[model samples]
Target: MSTRSEALLARPAAQLEVRQRITVLLTPPGLWLLLFFVIPLGVMALFSFRAASFGAQRQVFTLEHYQRFLADTSAQRLLWRSLLIALETSLICVVLAFPLAYFLSFRAGPSRLMLLTILVIPSWTSFLLRILAWKVLLGSSGIFNSLLLSLGWIEEAAPILLFSRGAVIITLVYIWVPFVALPIFAGLERINRHLLEAAEDLGSRPWQIFLEVILPLSLPGVLAGFLSVFIPTVGEYVTPLLVGGVDGIMYGNLVQDQFARALNWPLGSVMSLVMMLVVLVLTFGLGRGVKVTDLAGV
Candidate 1:
């Protein structure tokens, strides 16, 4: 072959090699998504349209589940409550997490890693166990009540603490705060310190610097934390089951009951699909408001 012909052949071969390498890199995740996420979601979507159990004599394709969810006042209330709690949890997490994230990112100069480790260590523990521990702590004779009693803060052990809506919110906050804080801390870390210095040099107060420079810069992290906490907390079943009592029951509990106790697979699938749709809508809506260019300054 001529030199030019040889070069042309080599170029094609290199391109082909690159294509094959890219394919190899993508294959595992692609297969994983197809098998675990896409396929399962598709199956659930199919199930949502059917009115049937796992094994039944007769089956019918219907919108009964969706209709029931829409028409039923109880279901509506449950869903509303779930969303309200999730929103509350996300907001509270943001408020609580911002201070911690700020400290971890800027103030925890030497022991930052240690503090972060302490924050993360609890997440490694069994989720159920954490909820249960909270249950114990808020119980009548639990450490919290004991301390209060010793301090002469209350006349009797507070029965209202253990199995109340407040307890549910508290536990949800406790569980989700770390998730929210970590993202905010990451956002704070990515912030250019020079910006804050410039603000200070320009005679900006501490709060002013934070409001203008820090808060704006760290918004991406706050959004991430909000999404992380809000999405899962909406369908939270376990925590409410453990500590929420009757008043804390959420849509997730109904979904769980439908699947596990009632054996109403179709109904459960509908609930799951509805929750998924809400999550997708909210995510897209929130994401649309955030400009990618805004983070470029970081």
Candidate 2:
């Protein structure tokens, strides 16, 4: 046989080996997702359609839960409120994180690792503890109120500081900023330094270079970080529970109340599915506008 024919014949064996390797690598994670995520989601969907009864002799499926949710103005308001708060939180995190990320990416130099470690250290603490810390800080006699009192800024502790929608947004922004910064930092790091140098050589000012080059390139990371914060915050119940009080109640709170307090699993499932669908839609919509693959330098 000719050399080309021998190589072509061997190519099938090589291709089979590669395929086997890929299957071996993907099998564990694929099975894990099937067992945990897909199965649970399917169960939830099934429950959503079923009548809200645990020990009924007959099983009936209906769309009344969804119908009720759609008709409930209060529930719809809460859903909109939750989405707005999540959007606000994501925007605030992006605003605050961008500066820190920029500094770390371009200015940290030898102290980059140390600064990044410091930035992430607080996140290593328990999530509940962090929320509780914010609770204390915003409380009547907390450090914030005390500082305001000592500084003669207020006659008394501000009741608006804790147990409100603002409190929920503030706490969530604080919690998510570190995580948001990491992606922006990664995106910034991936930018070709030569681009900036070339811009400088072309007489572009610092602000011009940032606006023209850096901002455009780093958008993917910004979007990724925004989605990261926005999606979870929309479904957040714990932070609002601890710090938001009655005023800060979100859509997720309604779901929790149905499942835990009201024993209405079907309604909760319906709400859960609706929230998931909304998030998926928003994510897909945004994905269409800005490709997240750019964040990975793909």
Best by TM-score: 2
lDDT of 2 by residue, 156-243 (tens): 8997899999999999999999888888888898899999999999999999999999999998888888887898999999999999
Summed over model 2, clashes come to 0
TM-score of each: 0.89, 0.92
TM-score for candidate 2:
0.92
In order, what lDDT does every prediction score?
0.86, 0.90
Summarize candidate 1's per-residue lDDT along 1-298 as a digit string, tens digits: 5776556557878668767878999999999999999999998888887878755522578888889877778876888899999999999999999999899989999898799989989999999999999999999999999999999999999988988888999999999898888878888888889999999999999999999999988888888888888988999999999998987788899999998999888888988988888888987888665444332312
Top lDDT model: 2
Q: Cα RMSD for candidate 1?
A: 4.8
Clashing pairs in 1: none
